[model samples]
Target: MSFDDFYHAHFRGLVVQLRAYTGDVAQAQDLVQEAFCRVFARWDQVSRYDDPLAWTRRVAWNLAHNRWRRLRTARAWLLRQREAHVAGPGPDRVALEAALAVLPARQRRAVILHYLADLSIAEIAAQEQVAEGTVKSWLHRARAALAAALRDTTEEAQDA
Candidate 1:
């Protein structure tokens, strides 16, 4: 049979079979189309075979298997990326967070903006609509309070 005749006769059957194997009509269609493209490239040799349909079917199945393997590997890599291999928050972090929570709102904001956000005193003062001196004062007080709180927590932990 002509290549066109062979394709028209078997395309639907191939897609149906691939869909049954993959459980995805779109993927099955893609696999079948790709398989046809490969056969079209070597139609002369393929047509001589007693069972060209078997060769086409095998190619499509291999395509589906390869896609599944690649997807499985990618899924495993993504899962690894999501997993947190590093340790959880230690005692020092917990103590620091607790200490920060107890401070006044202004002090907390100033400390976070200055240290965590890497904002300069002038930038923080401009953002907070306060004088630079006022920003410095907040940071100084916050530092002292945080130091005292962390020290107390450490002492308590040591005592316990």
Candidate 2:
């Protein structure tokens, strides 16, 4: 079967399978698309396989598994950071809140969405109706501003 025919026939089923595996439709769709790209790149040899669709599914599953692993690693690192911060003298909550309040609305929103809501950059971009790069820029500026404000607050407290 031609690649186009195979893709049309199997795309939906692959997405469904990946969704079941990943438990997130967006991630499943991404994995399936990535698998398709890989297959398309090597279609000459891939088509010779007895079960090209099976090959595609295997690649998609592997991609999903790798994504899961990376997410787990990230979560663990975040947890470690949280623990380390908790063990130390953290910034004053009142000062942190004040710093956040002083930020521009867009910067505050971007920070809250990414850190508090644990949203991905792509998710934040979609929700904010802005490009991912815009979201990133907002986050960068917000972090810098917050850090400077917090540092000033710390120095004031030390002087007092």
Candidate 3:
């Protein structure tokens, strides 16, 4: 099917799928558009897939997840910083963001998927294609790192 036809046929369903994956309706709609944009950008290549719709859905889901990770990370950092400033003796956003920015990719993804996206450990494992134990380990490490980051942020704020 042509891109236009695909867009018309699958738009709503894709949005719903993305929403389920993201746990956010607005992000899902944005991801649906982004998915179509990607499909059109590589139409020649992607169209050859036997099940292009599924391919698009997969890509869109990944995009939605990536966007969520980025936006939420930034927002969380900012909120922490703002709170730190208001608390007059707390962690700052910059220190926290820098700390979180250093996490290994899998640890970061596991943490975001579980806590921010409200996904279960099993769900995160399936989405990330990792073992559930791996996801759990990543989560444990991420939580430890977050605690350390918060401490560093507070220390830095105090020193400032």
Candidate 4:
């Protein structure tokens, strides 16, 4: 398919998929656009791939994770300044986001892919270019970390 047709057909699905990682529609849209731009920039190469959609999704997923990492570094600096804290009660979203932000990037990606995107471990392994066993290990560690991180919040409350 042509790039225009391909983009029009798959962009929204990619955006919705990215939303799970970002938990924000606007950010998801941005991630999708970035992914498309990457693919377009390398169209000669991308078009030769057997599954360009998978490549696009993986690109979006990776970008979202990178953005999350950058945010975490910035937030960590902000958090270190006890006096610079945003005063007053913040949204519960802050706590949830902070917890997620602290997870190791690979573990977070595994959890987001397995639970948030409802992908199987094998699928996650393929997207991440890791072994299935590694994906399982990541998932196990992620579950433990998330449980420890969000000890008080109801797990049921955080579904996107």
Q: Write the per-residue lDDT of candidate 3 for residues 1-160, one digit (tens) a residue.
A: 7878888999999988888888888988988998899999999888889999999988887897788799999999988778444444333556656777889989988877897899999999899888999999999998899899888777766899
- Show model 3 residue runs off by greater than 4 Å: 83-160
User: Considering every candidate listed, which one attains the maximal TM-score?
Assistant: 2
Please name the candidate that would achieve the greatest lDDT relative to the true structure. Answer: 1
Q: List the global CA lDDT of all models.
A: 0.97, 0.93, 0.86, 0.87
lDDT of 1 by residue, 1-160 (tens): 9899999999999999999999999999999999999999999999999999999999999999999999999999998888567788999999999999999999999999999999999999999999999999999999999999999998999999
- What are the per-model numbers of colliding residue pairs? 0, 0, 1, 0
Candidate 4 error regions (>4 Å): 84-160
Report the lDDT tens digits of candidate 2 across residue range 1-160: 8889988999899999999988989889999999999999999999999999999999999999999999999999988777444454455877888999999999999999999999999999999999999999999999999999999999999999
Clashing pairs in 2: none
The estimated TM-scores of all candidates read 0.53, 0.54, 0.48, 0.52
lDDT of 4 by residue, 1-160 (tens): 8899889999999888888767899999999999999999988889889999999989989999999999999999878876855676565767667777889999988888887899998899899998999999998888888777777565545663
Model 2 reaches what TM-score against the true structure?
A: 0.54
Q: For model 1, where is the 10-residue window of minimal lDDT? A: 79-88
Instruction: State candidate 4's TM-score.
Output: 0.52
Model 2 segments more than 4 A misplaced: 84-160
Task: Please list the residue runs of candidate 1 whose C-alpha ends up more than 4 Å from where it truly belongs after superposition.
Answer: 84-160
